[model samples]
Target: MQDFYIFAKNFHINKAIIRRDGYIYQSLIAFFMTGTGNSYTVARWCAQVAETTGIGSQLVQIKAGEKRGAVPSRSLAVFTYPTHGFTAPWLIMKYIWCLPNGRNLHAIVLPTRAGIRIKGAFFPGLEGTAGYLIAFLLWLRGYHVQGVMGVDMPSNWTALHWGLSKQNAAVIIEMAQSKVKGMLQTVLAGNKHYDGMVQLLVGIALAKVSLMYLIMAQFILAKLFFASDKCNGCSLCQSICPKKALKMVGRQGRPYWTFSCDSCMACMNYCPQKAIEVSPFIITLFYYIATVPVFAYAMSYAAGGDALQWGISLGLGFGIQYGYTLAAIALAYGLLHVALGSRIIRAIAAKLSHTHYFRRYQASNVSLKDIHLHK
Candidate 1:
């Protein structure tokens, strides 16, 4: 199942994007750390592999919830991230929609998720839909296109928590070599069915339900918990609030979420306030744990009776995957925070904001660690 297209593209590509969930801090560490299974790190490694094979390339970050400009020509735009509820982060949807065309633009979508094969199908679906839709839009707008590609990264946090003793850092390097090689082969072979397979996966009712949950989680629950007390009155949140839903109040302790909250969670995750409270990391952990059983129940609901055999099998398979995925992320968080300094988070927030969305708020005096953890 090796793809030759990926190989051909890898050897001659020029530009690419290295995406991450919720923040760039983790991504930067992943890039530097080598094995953490982070999307950015994995994608960068992939790019380098592609380079050695003859592709000249550049990698950039696509933050959790913002949009970026067109991928430069002859360049491969690589979108990477940890899957949230089986899909890319909510904000990444906009990025997919905005993908530029007309110049034989190629796409490489890398989704990092918990280590389950069932869940592995999720990101390909998201990437396919976004890519197909963009291609269609571009076609209408008069841009000739080549196509899109996708790869999966191990769920580092979940894997570590589940007792998967193998750190994702090493896997990062391995996946970069093997996965990129496979992708290159696929691309060169002109195998377009991957997109169709993505369509089939997404067409299912269960998949739709899963996607809806992700949307609500990002656009709803994520906002409330993200606004806790750790925010440092720094207006950085207000500055990058893509929806302009944040504003500084009387120069107090931190920027406050306004009525325009879209639940993007950028403020909560990136706020230097140390003022925001609540752990999105913890919340997501619980979410994966709880939903494992629910996916079981949902199948029962759809079948009019418990598909006990299917449920049992999937439960075991997906369960193991989730366990491993969660563990890896947790370990990554602990190791990077303690060893590398959570400053990666601040750096990511700053780098993420460096784009058009956060350009106005660039001059802030806030330090990445200036915000304290909530008591």
Candidate 2:
């Protein structure tokens, strides 16, 4: 099983979505993430929920080159994959594109990401937005849509470190079922609010901006400071990369990241070289600082902004919002990073040739990208 997790919260539940074609349309598209297997686990639960609710559900296992036009209509399309860097896998995007008139169709996106540094929820719901865009395109072709939600899974790398518990799994299944049920009801109620362009635009804008920032983070900030000298260029990073962004290209035979990187940190995390250093200390500092505030904003939204009881600090709220504004200043830089980070990292390496410990290990022709799995 791959990239599987559970959502155990009690939520509003709907039973089914009967398409105009007279078929209860429900579909699950999953890309099991490596190391954790949360994708597969979550997918199973989704299928189970669809069964329990008596909804017509279909499961599609999407690989690198799977076709999408073959999928039947009036169905719930569920996507389960791991986050590469901070975004969903390219394969997922490809699959979405393969869907005929994808934008106009409603889809449920469930991504299994690096649950170590953060929860899967730490992500800004880019996958859901992907579904929204797909649904929007499909809608233009006469397909209607529902909304998106998420479920977090535990990982050895994350705060949990411990493996998922059976109780946890049970809760996640029940909650997921409820949410799916609720979403189905919303679909049947003739509610058309979640069926338009605003959702699409917002989703696209956010994903675009995030991708831009991620690129910048990797190239400008990450590569400028870190060198893959230790990299023997064994291409282990290339092998594990769900995006196939990293390829062996250097004169020394080390894997170099191309523009296709999603920044899920698979290379960095799994780098045998340990040569990939995300540094300047300032960048990490900046990232964490920025992350905290951004997380706060997400929390605020989750709390319903003004509707919830939680209140923002009087003096700090304005500052935080302003701080977020400052962070937005990095968006241009982020875009630039994505545009040139890989090239710049390599170019600088060409200019300087100082060998260090991190370099020799990477150059050793051994698998240094070993993961320390937690029980």
Candidate 3:
């Protein structure tokens, strides 16, 4: 990969022409959609910047469960996607793997993450490396990776954490737009950048652990998802599913997720009626109750003959500790949900839907060179 970068740098310095001519080579911007539409927002911003700056680009929206198609040859390619479990979505990686090699192609990556802010202090919600991973994959496929830019977007994982309110989300969007504009300006200036070593290390560690967790825990916990009487049989969840994991079943037309679910929580978050409910605390309690005793027994047996005693002791200790934590959190959230949280979230969602937040970037495919020349 280092050698590829060196070669790419020399090639660009000696022979490659960076120009505003749209006909010279194609530029492709591909992105994967999730419930919160964060990645979609970043992709649109990138396209707007590229076009406004006289770089022609095209948009490719990748849907879930779709088979890989031929990769289009291009001089520049920008990849954008949301982070899942502190890493790139597995589906996005698969798409990268299927892309045909782009010899001497220049690439940029924009990965959107949901970070938490407490008392004006920001903490990354996930170990973000989706951009880096995509860049590395592109490099392996003979593309000259320009940079990996991480954009912090509003939190969408309401199941595990509180989501941003409408006002807070608006603030975040404005800040992100400003940051993206600066980054794009640097890229258009032919400069190069990379993430810090610490971030890369953290991303690597999280990716490893997250992969295991996804395989072992996600499907089991997904069983907790259920639609209430409020579900109106709209089938919006089924239609929007990228993986085609959801199917409207029964006469009542409730959405049922299959094993193919990536657990992106799009269905749960976007449900209009607030019908689909997934209690993360309850899932946590169930997970510990089901697995803690077995794990404790195994560890105790490996240590000595008092396996039963050790197992019972360890199980009780962990169970009580985790149980108490989850219970308190659940109680607080339940009260908040009943009192105000539900209404607030629904209002925000309604605002977002009415504004067509996901569709705002529909004009991203316009040729920047034409626009510039026309002006």
Best by lDDT: 3
Encode model 1's per-residue lDDT on 172-291: one tens digit a residue: 335545765576445433342233355425634345655665534343333223233334455666665545665554434334443345443345445454344434454565455435
Give the range where candidate 3 is weakest over 10 consecutive residues by summed lDDT.
1-10
- Candidate 1: TM-score? 0.45
> Any idea what lDDT model 3 has?
0.59
Clashes of each: 56, 49, 1
**In model 1, which range of ten residues has the least summed lDDT?**
24-33
CA lDDT scores, all candidates in order: 0.41, 0.45, 0.59
Per-residue lDDT of 1-375 in model 3, one digit per residue for the tens?
A: 111111112111112225453323334454445445676677777777766655455555666644444334444566777777667777778777766666676777877777556566666645456677778887887777877778777767655555665556666678888987787666656776665457667878777666755554455444445555567889877766666777776666666656566766667666677666664444665565445444444444436547676767676666655455444444543443333224455344334332222211111223322221111
Over 87-203, each residue of candidate 2 has an lDDT whose tens digit, in order, gives 544555565555554434455555543322233222222233544443444455444445544444433232112333444434444454455446545544434324324534654
Which regions of candidate 2 fall more than 4 Å away from where they truly are?
1-22, 26-41, 50-68, 73-75, 80-95, 102-106, 111-131, 153-234, 250-252, 270-276, 281-375
Which residue ranges in model 3 land beyond 4 Å of their true spot? 1-28, 67-74, 118-121, 280-285, 288-375
* RMSD to the hidden true structure, all candidates: 15.9, 14.6, 10.4
Off by over 4 Å in 1: 1-37, 60-104, 116-150, 154-173, 185-203, 207-217, 226-251, 258-276, 279-375
Top candidate when judged by TM-score against the true structure: 3
Could you tell me how far off, in angstroms, the CA of residue 127 lies in candidate 2 after the best superposition?
8.0
In what order do the candidates fall by TM-score, top score first? 3, 2, 1
Candidate achieving higher lDDT, 1 or 2 = 2
The superposed Cα distance between candidate 2 and the true structure at residue 283, in angstroms, equals 5.6
